[model samples]
Target: MFDQDKDTGGLQGKVILITGGTSGLGAQCVLRLALNNASHIYFTGRNTKKGSAIIKETHDAGCTTPLTFVECDLTKLASVKAAADKILSEQHRLDLLMANAGVMNQPPGLTADGYEVQFGTNFLSHALLIQKFLPLMDKTAELPGSDVRIVQLTSTGFRGAPSGGIRFDDLKTVQNFRVLGGMMRYGQSKLAAVLYAQELARRHPNIISVSVTPGIVSTELVSKQNAFHRSTIWLSAKITQGRIYSPKEAPASQLWCAVGPRNEIKQGAFYEPVGILSKITTKYTQDEDLAWRLWDWTQSELKQWLD
Candidate 1:
């Protein structure tokens, strides 16, 4: 039997980057990676106070893993570029890039770049970060036995997206914006994330590019919802058998994707719950044509900023 408590010890000396690492699942991932002795970690968030606290706690626990906090507001593309540039300047290679920062349902709004809130934060910003960091990841992959990886944090909420999938025409929700449409919008963003990972894996066979869902975890994700929405979720959970994982348990799948045996997990696969390979519950997620279309659309969207 595989020892559930055994340490595999793979992250030592690795340089890792995690977005939205200030709290929740991202924070858990940071702790795990640090405990495994990653040489350096660059985590992005807007809260310096919280970031400092996480850093202090890690050091207090006798972890020598150097942690650097980059103040990145994922809602702003400019901030994303600045954070990526800072990492590029300091690190010759990034062994792992976990695009873990995301927001759930929120009142209709636009990002600093005018994209929908959920789509911009959960998908587009992450897409840009991966593009900016690919050169460094590719350089690291050239090393023998190096597991240079890009892990996108997706969710089961993706199953809630529209049947046709990825409303490319109205990603901004300009035509039909509903206050309660946040759930579907969140799902769409996550689906885009999965497709982005699939397309990336196809384009770059040498590196590991995959998305993962942690299942439902009890976290601050629910705190943002209004009272009615929150109550509805609580009631729905009671109606169905919903497994809510703890923060520690939630990050396990992503941690596995980041450092587990490369041969055990396929590139571009959508992994779920405690490190198992599982396809998302949607054919659109695996649609190669749709994946390429998303890729092309994303590239064109980022062209102005990328240039």
Candidate 2:
């Protein structure tokens, strides 16, 4: 289920950063990357205890990779910047970035940066982090055989996004505000992940930027849902007996895109089902103009963090 013994020369000496690495799929990526010999693995999360446990778990498993923790609260742009700055100070090169931190359906609210919570935490902050860390990434680009990659963990929820995609005017307002609105907002953010990856790949040909859907994994993501949605899932599970992937399986597509052969991945692509270049069936997700508009809007809104 993992490339435990595969030669990791491709990842040797590489510095990797993964957000939301305290639990779930992000945790799996951290361990797997450590096993594969990433020289420095820095994972971000708000929970210091969980962070310490993850570090210890790796060591107990005989992981020799250098592991560090960067305390980051994704809902706050300032926190994200502080974490990035810490990495910039310590790591000379950032070989891979896993934009894996995100929130699912939640009550309407603003991030510390004042944007919608889901959109802000899931997409906006990550977009800024990529911008903030580009210099470090580019430094690695100068090295021979270096594969600088950014993998955005989008979701199947993207297909259910709102009618016109991102609501540019009402970025702060949640129309319904609860279950329905929360899902729509979550979808919008996930769609942004897909579009962001696409636009990033197009703009930076030297680096790899791609999004992947991990396919309905059984994790805390579902546990965050309201009771109504939970009941629906329970009933659906009883009737269809559907396949809910394990947390270990959830990071497969992401790891594949992150460490797979260069030629196998199509740059600017969204992947799914372990490892395949599946197209984003959503029309809005594939809109180049919309992607650029979102990028520009994010930059304009986050001008203070651009430095």
Candidate 3:
């Protein structure tokens, strides 16, 4: 275990950003980082009400650190860009960027931009956010003793992805071909996260980029699943009898990645809970060629926004 208690105080004066900070693991991350005394914390979510509640909750907890909520709906690229631009215009340095918001096992659909829903919301939006912030992150890394990190949250569910990792041929479609359509699409999106982190580390050596799994937490992401999918989740839970962490307990690895000593975490690696560098048996996840290809594809897709 990664102990949050021991990790306190290091984040003083650090600037941090998290996605989906209104609830679940994202909310917990906000609380933890605020408690750790981060100088300024910016988190993104669609719910202004919940965002306000989080700020209040943090203040009530006696964490006087400033928390700003950037209204963002990841389904729309334009909204993502607006949020990024706002943050970039305001913040001089970004020490940590946590790509933590995501949907899991969602029904077949497309984003506002016409890509598969999970792919767009989970992977592409975070990609855009990271891309938009790289310059500031680079500047931060140049400062003496600055430790800039980008943490992308992925899942072991990537095992369920299509054999090829990502179905590039039909990313613009719903990807409803197979029996486990939702999971397959979810896995595909998450696999993209892992590959993207790897590519990011290669391209930006100054930043520490890694993907991580929270190890099956119970959150709104689970409760929002449709009836059939919910039952499948229930069945799996019963079979494994696995320990499902609460939001607070689940973000240990992410927090550790965000603030843990720079020498301890490998650049561009995948970690399980509490900073364990997991061995990725899936061959596709280890494919450098596929990682680069996905990077090229993402850049092409987001060319307009990038310009």
Q: TM-score each candidate.
A: 0.93, 0.93, 0.96
In angstroms, the error of model 1 at 14 is 1.0
Residue-wise C-alpha lDDT for candidate 1, range 182-255, written one tens digit per residue: 88888889999999998989998888999998776778887677898778766655554274567776677787
Q: Write the per-residue lDDT of candidate 3 for residues 1-307, one digit (tens) a residue.
A: 5687567468877999999999988998899889887889999999999999999999999988999999999999999999999988888999999999999988889999999999999999999999899989999999998999999999888988986899898999998866888899999999999999999999999999999998777898888888887777767765643656777788887888888878999999999878889985488899999999999999999889989
lDDT of each: 0.84, 0.84, 0.90
lDDT of 2 at 133: 92
Error of 1 at 155 (Å): 0.9
- In candidate 1, the residue pairs with backbone N, CA or C atoms under 3 Å apart (3 or more residues apart, or in different chains) clash, namely none
lDDT of 1 at 109: 82
For residue 160, give model 2's deviation from the true position in Å. 1.5
Question: Residue 173's C-alpha lDDT in candidate 1?
Answer: 53
Displacement of the residue 153 alpha carbon in candidate 2, Å: 0.6
lDDT of 2: 0.84
**Candidate 2 lDDT tens digits, 175-264:** 454448888999999999999888888878889999998777778878877789877655655554366678886687788888888888
